[model samples]
Target: MTRLKQLRFEVFGVFFRQCTVDHARQLGLVGWVRNTEHDTVVGVAQGPEAGIADMRHWLREVGSPQSSIASAQFDETDIAELEHESFGVRRR
Candidate 1:
């Protein structure tokens, strides 16, 4: 449970921002999600092992509302440490 981790997902359409917000809150994760200019949404979540797992589950099950998710890609990474702040949508 000490391994570093990170998640990157893409949601196509206009339903990403809102859905991500709710999902992150439900999972008790702390990170930020934002929309790309290419019509895709991207996000990053970092925290305890259990919390991150819950977040992944939510995204996989119901992360988008008005948008039809074309695909999702995620992987683990070596982060120095988790951030000390609230998680929410970020302007990009």
Candidate 2:
């Protein structure tokens, strides 16, 4: 848990914003997720390397039960500490 990372991601599909928030929190990540005007779910997740990897898999493969995920994109960076204090959903 010493290694931390930050990743910005966009997930295409529906009913994924809250799902993302729950998953991120479960992974002990700290970041925010929101729905875009384009109807995509977008957010940043920062946490341990392993948790990040798990989250990546979840976002890319397994999302909300009702969601029909078409695709996902991610841009990651190495970080020394978390930029967010907790994982959540944002209005913006």
Give the whole-model CA lDDT for all candidates, comma-separated: 0.70, 0.91
User: Residue 25 lDDT in model 1?
Assistant: 70
> TM-score of each candidate?
0.75, 0.95
Decoy 2 TM-score against native: 0.95
Give every collision pair in model 2. none
- Stretches off by above 4 angstroms in model 2 are none
Residue 71 of model 2 has an lDDT of 92
Where does model 1 exceed 4 Å of error?
1-4, 78-80
Tell me the tens digit of each residue's lDDT in model 2 across 1-92.
Answer: 48899989998876778888888998999999999899899999999999999999999989989899899999999998788899988996
How far does residue 34 in candidate 1 sit from its true spot (Å)?
A: 0.6
> Of the candidates shown, which would achieve the greatest TM-score relative to the real structure?
2
